[model samples]
Target: MRFLVQRVSDSSVEINGEVVGQIGKGFMVLIGVCDSDTKEIADKMVRKMLGLRIFEDEQGKTNLSLDTVGGQLLLISQFTLYANCKKGNRPSFIEAGEPGMAEEMYEYIIARCKEQVEVVERGQFGADMKVSLTNDGPFTIILDSEQL
Candidate 1:
């Protein structure tokens, strides 16, 4: 599993020109799942992501967690995060989880997120999505399960 976390002022996902999910003042996370990913790994990743204190506080210090700031969430499934480009110009998705299992994991992550976040929005799994966001601070973090 891998989480590409981007702190955003606002974010939205569209499919066929219809907006599906959106959030404000929160993290727009692109979640990637691999064959070895488990619920435990997902749990740990979510914990690390939620615990991140990248948001600035009153003192202009980056000292606030998502909970402290009452932030929402916009989660999207992105298998491309696991794309392997070591061999050629084209990327290979062989490291990404199979569709069925990946979708299940994706849904599980969203449900787990909803348990902590008051507003957890998500894009449709396997859909052709157009995502838009205003990256706050242009701040981003990549959380890989292997590193965690």
Candidate 2:
């Protein structure tokens, strides 16, 4: 499992011109699942994401967690995060998880996030999603299960 997390002032996801998910003053997260991923890894990601102290506090320090700032969450599934481009011009998704397991883990992540996040919005899994966000501080973090 892997997560690409970006702090955002606002974010939205559109599929076929219809808005599917949106958030404000929160993290815009893209989730990717690998073939070997399990819910345990997903759980670890959820804990790290919400607990990350990246939001600003009154002292203008990046010391507040999402919960402390009452931030929302905009989560999206992105199999392309696992793209392998070492061999050729075209990227290979061979490291991406199978659709069924990936979607399941994706859904599981969403459910867990909903519990900790004040507002949790999610893009449709497997959809051709168009995501837009105003990155806060242009901050981003990438988390991989292998690192845990």
Candidate 3:
């Protein structure tokens, strides 16, 4: 499992020209599931996302968790996160989980996030979607479960 976490002032996802999900003052999480990913990986990622202290506190220190800041979450399924380009110009997604498992993990993450945040919005799992966000502090973090 992997995640691209960006602190955002606002974020939204649209599919087929219709707004699907949106959030404000939160983190936009681009999630990728690998073939080995299981419910354990999904659970771990959700816990880390909710607990990561990247938001600013009263002293202007980046010490507040999402819950402390009352922030939302925008989760987007992005298998491209697992792209492997070592062999050629084109990237290979062979490391990513198949559609069925990927979709299951994606939905599981969303359900878990909804329980901990003020709001948890999600992009269409396998749809052509457009995502927009205003990055807060220009802070971006890339996380991989295997690294942890």
Candidate 4:
């Protein structure tokens, strides 16, 4: 599992110009899963996303967790995150997990996140979605289960 987390002041996802998911003052997390990803890995990623201290504190330090500031989450499934471009121009998605199983694990992450996160919003599992966000601090974090 991979989590591309962006701190956003506000964010929204649209399909056909119609808003589907959105959030205010929180993170816009794009998730990617591989065939080897298990529920345990998903659970670990959820723990990190919720507990990792990326938000700013009163002392102007990046030391606050999402829950500390009452932030929300806009989770989106992005298989393309695993696209491999080493071969040619066209990216290969051979590393991305199968749709059926990946969607189940993605939903599992969402459910786990909602357990501690007060406001959890999400994008459609497999959709051509357009996402927009005002990045807070332009701060981004890429978390991979293999590294953590």
Residue by residue across 18-132, what tens digits does model 2's lDDT show?
Answer: 9989999999999999989988888988999899999988999999999998999999999999999999799999999999999999999999998777799999999999999
For candidate 1, write residues 1-148 as lDDT tens digits: 9999999999999999999999999999999999999999999999999999999999999999999999999999999999999997999999999999999999999999999999999999999999999999999999999998
Q: Which residue pairs clash within candidate 1?
A: none
Considering only N, C-alpha and C atoms within 3 Å, which residue pairs clash in candidate 2?
A: none
1-148, model 3: which lDDT tens digit per residue?
9999999999999998999999999999999998899898888878887889999888999999888888999999999999999997999999999999899999988888877776888999989999999999999999899987
Point out the worst 10-residue segment of candidate 2 by lDDT: 110-119
Count of steric clashes across candidates, in order: 0, 0, 0, 0
Count clashing pairs, candidate 4: 0
Best by lDDT: 1
Number of the top TM-score candidate: 1
lDDT of each: 0.97, 0.94, 0.92, 0.94
lDDT of 4 at 10: 100
Full ranking by lDDT? 1, 4, 2, 3
Candidate 1 residue runs with Cα over 4 Å from true position: none
Residue range 30-147, candidate 4, lDDT tens digits? 9999999999999889888888798888899999999999999999999998999998899999999999999999899989988888889999999999999999999999999999
lDDT of candidate 2 at residue 80, scale 0 to 100? 96
Q: Clashing residue pairs, candidate 3?
A: none
Query: TM-score for model 1?
Result: 0.99
TM values, all candidates: 0.99, 0.98, 0.97, 0.97
